[model samples]
Target: MEEGAKHVVTGGGPQSGHCRSVSLICRPLGMKPHVVIEGVEKREDLGSMGNTLLYRMAGSKLYLAPQENYESFKRRVRKMKQYVSDTYGEKCYCIPVGGATGKAVFAFISLFDELLQQGLHDRFDDIVVTVATGGTSLGLAVANYLTGSKLGVHAVTIALRKEEIYENMDKLLKELGIDSVKSADILDIIEGYVGERYGTATEEVLSFVTEVSSSTGILLDPYYTGKGTMGMVGELVNNPSRFKGKRILFIHTGGIFGLFNGEMDRVINKEKAVTNDITPWLDENVSPVSIEQ
Candidate 1:
């Protein structure tokens, strides 16, 4: 369906599962392609659960560029992969940040238009998205610019500093060919959720994860969704009157890490295996759901 999708390139950062997910698309999504993965962050944990799956499925065609971070990876892998991207002649399939800005923003605009037509757009006062590499958050920023949508777009930054995230968003906006737009009028990035270093979750983060999953039945991986939700919930609860009777849409940046060292992680992983054992509870009384105002 996509040209130049045959070769997948990614920053195999240990912090997020995005690159790992990108690897899966190479085989099943289309033709058999060569994958060049750049392992930017080299921790003792070595690789992620995603890296493991990518290695297993990609086979011999997969080329790995393992290094400490950006500079090292670029030096080791980037220069050699010039022929990988048909469009850029340098980049791989997924750019995660600037590469996806234009595409992501335009896609969200289509969704926003549909919501407007259905009269569903009036409900939300603010929109929050999980920000790691800035693609998703910056995407909504561009959508706001193009549509002139009144709904506020906020980012719950997961890893980077606020200044860095904002700077990246501005750079991405320019790269998306939508320059000279004022970010203050369109986007707000909140940086109250970094907790510790990337992939290092504190006790509070795990607690929040357990509470939300138990309450909403939403599986939030530690890296993105869990931290993102924690940031949103904290704001709403602390300043109740500010968002009272207002609907704020929190975007769940989905992943499949199955978070570690928490009760939710154990249950999330174990429940599938023991589902037959809980057959009696399966038919328990449950009411049908309806759209909430």
Candidate 2:
């Protein structure tokens, strides 16, 4: 976050929004971005899709790490940071995966406070969001507790298990100098939403995504918002008595570009549109006039 820093290094999966965001914000700050990607061994293997394409377009230097090797990923990021320091004589600001650091939680806390200020707490009974790294949901829960709001915070887990999500939130809570409160007590982490694993989409969810986009004009990516929305819908259908009259606020975290990461196009359109001829529509009565400036 230091203005004097010349480079920012971060790590995430190929379709990670955090990587794309870091790379994007670095450009205007005159800071070069180095993104370490998981699930691949080289750049060639990291195809130009979704956030990966955005990272390249933002001019970020890319590094590859093994999919499941956490130690190797950390080492790769560290090396990239050190390499930037050695070559450019400047310290590189490193952001963890999903930007899910302790300090990052404060942002969502601030957001919650803003919502309270706008009196959104009175409008909605529950707050629903997709839990990727648990930072946003944790922050919201913390804010809810701190502000004494009764609104329920429900986080639909996309990738990690509920235990893992709790662990991440607990670590963040400790970082904020709070140990008395547990994350599980504050957050309602819902399960059974992650279909076909992370980054993989199901046909049903894809259909829902298209329907939501077409009807509401609010695009939801298959990875994050789409799944979260589907989960929210499922919750309503499965337990109508619980939320019969309660209004729910479903947070649409920005990942519209993620729709391009997979087979969303296939769901939106079964086949490509045929090219049309406009020659017949042209009026013969009006002569084409060319005005040269």
Candidate 3:
């Protein structure tokens, strides 16, 4: 578990969402994650979330990654973490976004297994999945690989470079013992809706998420689900007939806690808090009428 892991925290970004969930679950089992952060201060929520997780869940505090762009921030964090790990001789397993190939593949297989068992698999013409680290997307791509392209398992790039993403998917299949499905075979990458960069959600993006939440009671975190859903909706809305016989099923991997970050909180709810103008502070009004201390 220590080879790919470090004490450092990286939950602020969308790709880091999966990492956060994994760390939280594994922390109680004596795995204390600690590392230094450097330049990753693009959004208020990223900082707030990192610190909040450290305070409530672990014995250590969060370190800010250096203030570089998303890619550079990741690089700096990785280098610092390696330095610490090598110095202290700590081991961490660095699984990719969907817990590597086997897990990712099985996740989709299991999902579709149940759906197919329930007589629900034949209803969809397409399955829209998110490709953050190419974990789950690659898995579903495997499923599509098995289906011989009957079920359109298209992945939308929410973060990272699309080229590397497809490559990762190809590698994941190879790791999963599926030798035939190449990148070009099982890859259908949709781009242009990442909202600037990782962990950064645009105003329009938040609006759609809020609307979806209000209407369906299915909350979507901004980074992963929000971006993927927005992309799917935009495509379907703009070109209805393109998928006329197609039933689009958008898969939402759970990451609700990521929504509590500062950036998300800012746009999630604009309604004022319920209050009676109740005095929240002690009477500093005793300007001249104060008793001797």
Candidate 4:
């Protein structure tokens, strides 16, 4: 929920079987909220999907800000570097990879900016490693082209539906006038560890999240950190020779709240019933019978 983002609700007037409504909370960069209102007559009810008010706000497209993501990424990178150096007594480097969910793209861009400021641009490079996802990958591609970083960006995507990644990346690059983005087979780097489902949490990821929390008391969100960590671990385990003892920093983008919902609580309670140890005492207090030794 960024600033100036308005939550607009549009629905039926407490009646009608076709209660189809759509609400859009759009906050464009610096513009104020522009509301577009529309009304439909009762005679226009075509079907379940068509009888609705289509509200479209004009001038709401310019409020896109990447600064928030950049700031968050900077903070996480600083913390991670500090943690690694303090714990391992060694300096490490972080690379921005994966899709843009959980502000991955913004963080990657912000990391590049910070590196430029710290004069570490020459020491580290940025690579766009696709994870069979779309949003973050496209975001990374767009940001890379926009920032004009000289680091090598290799778009490594999984073999599953990789053509889509290639197509989207090319379209984005072409739109941005960036003609040098390269695509590579991520299998060599990532090592086909993706399981049956597209975005389902892997056992390795679940175990990693559990172990990390148990050891450090830091919870990693299932979607971004868990999956991203699984990918990193797969890379490390299968392609250890590639890293060659080099420090690998996995950016834990914060999204822990995603794991919680009303249904999740119900599921957890169902699995492990909560018990209240209550002892009922009579109004006339029957004193505890002390075992006199």
RMSD, every candidate, angstroms: 7.9, 6.1, 8.0, 17.3
Worst 10 residues of 4 by lDDT: 12-21
Candidate 2, residue 290: Cα displacement in angstroms equals 37
- Please, what are the lDDT tens digits per residue for candidate 1 over residues 34-94? 4445443333434435445554455514455553443454344454345556544443443
Each prediction's whole-model lDDT (CA): 0.59, 0.81, 0.62, 0.38
Report the poorest 10 consecutive residues by lDDT, candidate 1: 272-281
User: Per-residue lDDT of 139-186 in model 2, one digit per residue for the tens?
Assistant: 998998887748888899887889988987898889999897999988
- Identify the runs in model 2 with alpha carbons over 4 angstroms from their true place: 1-3, 69-80, 240-245, 271-293
lDDT of each residue in 224-276, candidate 3, tens digit only: 88889888888787865544256777888776665676665555455431211
Top candidate on TM-score is 2
| Pairwise lDDT winner, candidates 2 and 4 | 2
Please tell me which model should have the higher TM-score, number 1 or number 4: 1
**Whole-model lDDT for model 3 versus the true structure?**
0.62
In the predicted model 4, the residue pairs found to clash are: 28-63, 29-63, 29-64, 99-136, 100-136
**Higher-TM-score candidate among 2 and 3?**
2
Give lDDT: candidate 3, residue 221.
75
Q: Which candidate order results from sorting by lDDT in descending order?
A: 2, 3, 1, 4
* Deviation (Å) of 59 in candidate 2: 0.8
Give the Å error, residue 2, model 4.
17
